[model samples]
Target: MPLILIIDDDPMIREMLITAFHQENYDVMGADNGKTALDIFRTEDVDVVITDIIMPDMEGIETIREFRKIKPDAKIIAFSGGGSLAPDGYLKIASSMGAQYTFQKPISIKVLSEAVKDLLGSCKKKL
Candidate 1:
């Protein structure tokens, strides 16, 4: 099964995604911050990462950059509720940092599920 890592400071959001992905038959892992997420990333063969842009202790942009360093071809999906700027602004930065997909807060679980399937499909094609 594919492994997905979800990083968000909001416990509700984290758990919500975890449950959704679990129902989709994906192995899921959750972290409250990018720092903890990265620790899991380093140890696990994570196929996709869904991260909040404005997290405490490392933030999404920096985490994306670090992920790229560790695995340049890593599949990443970034989301933000916005902080000091609109969610679009932060999502744009995440895209430039190598996030394959971006979403605003209050994302639809169906859309996220499709994005994960798409990324995983592309990963399979590359291999």
Candidate 2:
């Protein structure tokens, strides 16, 4: 099964995502901050990362940048509830920095699963 790492500060959101992904048979790990997420990333064979833009320790944008450096072809899906600026601004930056997909807050798990499948499928093709 594919491994996925989810980075979000909200406990409820984290649990919700975990449950959603688990139902799809994907092994999932959750982190409360980008710092911890990075630690897990270095140690695990994470196939995809779903991160929130606004987070403590390290923000998702910085996380995505580092992920690209660590693994250039890292599959990333970034999302945000919009901080001071609109969510689009942050998502746009994430995309330019190498995030393969972006979504605003309250994303449907069904859609996220499909996106993950599409990304993984594309990566396999490239290999």
Candidate 3:
């Protein structure tokens, strides 16, 4: 199965994403922050990354940047609840920086499943 890593500070968000991807049979890993998520990447062949925009440590945008340095062609999805602070078109920035897509918070499982399938399918073809 393809591997997916989920990075979010919110416990509920991480659990929800983990449950969704697990049910789809993908090997899923979760991290409480971007730093831990980066560590998980070192130990796993993660096919896709779903990360939040903000966190207490490292921050999702910085994580994405470094992930690209090590794995330039990584497949990543930037997700966020926004929570009040946004650096203006953050999603667009993420896309330009290498994220395959940016999804807003409260996404339906069906939508998420389809997006994950599409992104992972594309990534698989590259592999």
Clashing pairs in 1: none
Instruction: Name the lDDT value of residue 23 in candidate 2.
Output: 89
* Candidate 2 Cα outliers beyond 4 Å, as residue runs: 124-127
Q: Indicate whether candidate 2 or candidate 3 has the larger TM-score.
A: 2
**What would the per-residue lDDT of candidate 3 be over residues 71-119, giving only the tens digit for each residue?**
8878898877675566446776777789887877776778777777888
> What C-alpha lDDT, on a 0 to 100 scale, does residue 18 get in candidate 2?
94
Q: Estimate each model's TM-score.
A: 0.96, 0.95, 0.89
* Alpha-carbon shift of residue 115 in model 1 (angstroms): 0.3
Cα lDDT tens digits for candidate 2, 44-102 = 99999999999988999999999999999999999999998899999999999999999
Query: Any runs in candidate 1 off by more than 4 Å, and if so which?
Result: 125-127
Error of 1 at 36 (Å): 0.6
Scored by lDDT, model 3 comes in at 0.82
Task: Give candidate 3 misplaced runs (Cα > 4 Å).
Answer: 125-127
Model 2: clashing residue pairs?
Answer: none
Clash count, predicted structure 1: 0
Give candidate 2's total backbone clashes.
0
The RMSD (Cα, Å) of candidate 3 is 2.3
Mind giving the per-residue lDDT tens digits that candidate 1 earns over 16-99?
999999998889999999899989999999999999999887999999999999999999999999999999999999999999
- In TM-score terms, candidate 2 sits at 0.95
